[model samples]
Target: MEDCLRIAVAQIPVTTDARANGREIRAAMRAAAGAGARLIQFPEGAASGYPSGAAKAMLAGWAVDWAALREELEEIAALAAELSLWTVVGSSHALTAPNRPHNSLYVISDTGRLVARYDKRLLSFSELADWYAPGAEPLVFEVDGFRFGCALCIEIQFPEIFVEYARLGIDCLLLSSFSRDPMFAIQVQGHAACNAYWIGFAVPAQCGDAASSGLAGPDGRWIAQAPQAATRLLS
Candidate 1:
């Protein structure tokens, strides 16, 4: 068992263009490698961009190319293998119609394998509830000696999920969110303090007023944070 692990929280802007998002992800992976981080986490919808209400409306007219999205994901996995880094990133997973896709987190191992996937269990009533299907199972994976659990966006508002992770003996929680509200930081800190575990929060750089991508210790204090509106690698 390793005594310590180095992880990176990548806070970067995401767009509707999957190729552009892929480039950003590659760049973040390189930065994580340079920082000597073995694992990296990216914000929710990092690959597809968290569609706004406006974008959501446009989806009806826009035809989504699932093939291209899959290719981009493959490219990310290749990059992870080249850098020997594990990655946790958010992307949309397609489902058979008339079911909508899932808002999911992909766990890629150092070998570039898609080891696990975590879908957002709790759907927000506002935008996501109509767009995504709720996930029923929890996702937990391990690195070195540390066990990590996954969550997305509004799930932070629920304490039961965090409690479940604590019961499962996770040392850390990886959260990917697009929320720009100041309450985001407060909720995460409270969860960390209450659960007595480390937490990594990742949000898009363009998310105005969003709490910066940061890692908090078991004490619920920030150990590191990215600069406002800047694309940065926080470890």
Candidate 2:
């Protein structure tokens, strides 16, 4: 197969309202399908834009509502089927079964099946010792003819991980980040410069006080960049 791929990059704003967030994502996925896109990427925590674990706040304990997130993701599954599209989304995973919570990326197939999960590695100081459990293992998921690896948010900073995936002959790299800083350019360029033939998928938390999501080409160029303060679709 050729080493070319068509990806739909979505940069929609997210909120704590699951229903609203779901509705927007469903629409975007449908648009992506209509455009003949095989894969669609969305912002980090696309399901619920709930802020990252805030420190020493009354809401600190409120972030791990596993039951609620499960139901929300189930609906997202159904929506994926409706659109007949594959989706990669960055979101928070509620902790259950005696483990701490995680910032995760969920991969959904066209048939509404949840194919795999990749938890974010390189946890921040906040997450390293508290709030989340560090992710284990590397994920290489296949969609269409594409073999892609998944890494969430800050994990892309670590060059060794992507090198490992490239050594395995991955065709694409899906990176999800929640950064608002200008270093984002460095992140995307670095992801491409090191991997050379690799394309990076970045779906940030969205336009607000923070940065939005976007896509970068193998040449280390921006394919599409969501606005800093507005939600948009980046093809």
Candidate 3:
């Protein structure tokens, strides 16, 4: 691991097709690799729409499809191996025990190995808690000799998580989410700035709605930003 590792933030548009999204992600990873980035981050719930109401049906059936998820994750891992860039992407995942689903974030090594899984800890009161289970584990991974902490979406708002990670000596933080609220986005940015840690805000946006999709550095500045419309955010 190098001391001065460059990380790339990818800004991408979200579509209804998962394969298409995957392809776009693949391209973004390659581009980041070309940019000399050792690690890359992606948006939350990117595997499926950040649905509300009845649209939850879009993610209904695939809890046990670990094999398929592996295949998709492998695409990233292969890229990591070929380009030697560690990757993180948001996902639609299910638990093996009860077959429940979770909004997940995964870190894949350059060799395509699944390093860690962090489920979205905070679910929206309206749509999320009812559909997805609260994640049990905290985010922790190694990149460029630095121990990094990770979270999905709303986790960035709760200062406790950041305190815990900072006390544990985390050097950086990466977050993936699909919240479309600008206020929430600002909250995340503020949290990162106050903590003085490198934070990646990988979140999905609503079509033309007030949304935030971007990356934040330790100084609490926007490193990269995505439009409110369908798009990607890479920093």
Best candidate according to TM-score = 1
Can you write out model 2's per-residue Cα lDDT over 113-179, one digit (the tens) per residue? 9999888877878766656777787888887678988877667677888788888888778776666
Q: Between 2 and 3, whose TM-score is larger?
A: 2
TM-score of each: 0.96, 0.87, 0.84
Per-residue lDDT of candidate 1, residues 1-235 (tens digit): 9999999999988877788888999999999999999999999989876665456765663345678789999999999999999999998888898888888999999999999999998998854556788889998999987899999989998999999999999999999998788899888899999999999999988873568889988999988988877888886
Ranking the candidates on TM-score from highest down gives: 1, 2, 3
Judged by lDDT relative to the true structure, which candidate is superior, 1 or 3? 1
Q: Judged by lDDT, which candidate is best?
A: 1
Which residue pairs collide in model 2, if any? Answer: 45-90, 153-176
What does candidate 3's lDDT look like per residue over 1-235, in tens digits? 6667777666565554566667778888888887777888877755444454234565464322455555666676777788877888887675676645777877888777778888877776744545677787677888768888878766766888888777777778887766556676677678778888877776544522565566677888877666667555354
**Candidate 2 lowest-lDDT run of ten:** 53-62
Instruction: Please say which candidate is ahead in lDDT: 1 or 2.
Output: 1
Tell me how many residue pairs clash in candidate 2: 2
**Model 1, position 94: C-alpha lDDT score:** 85
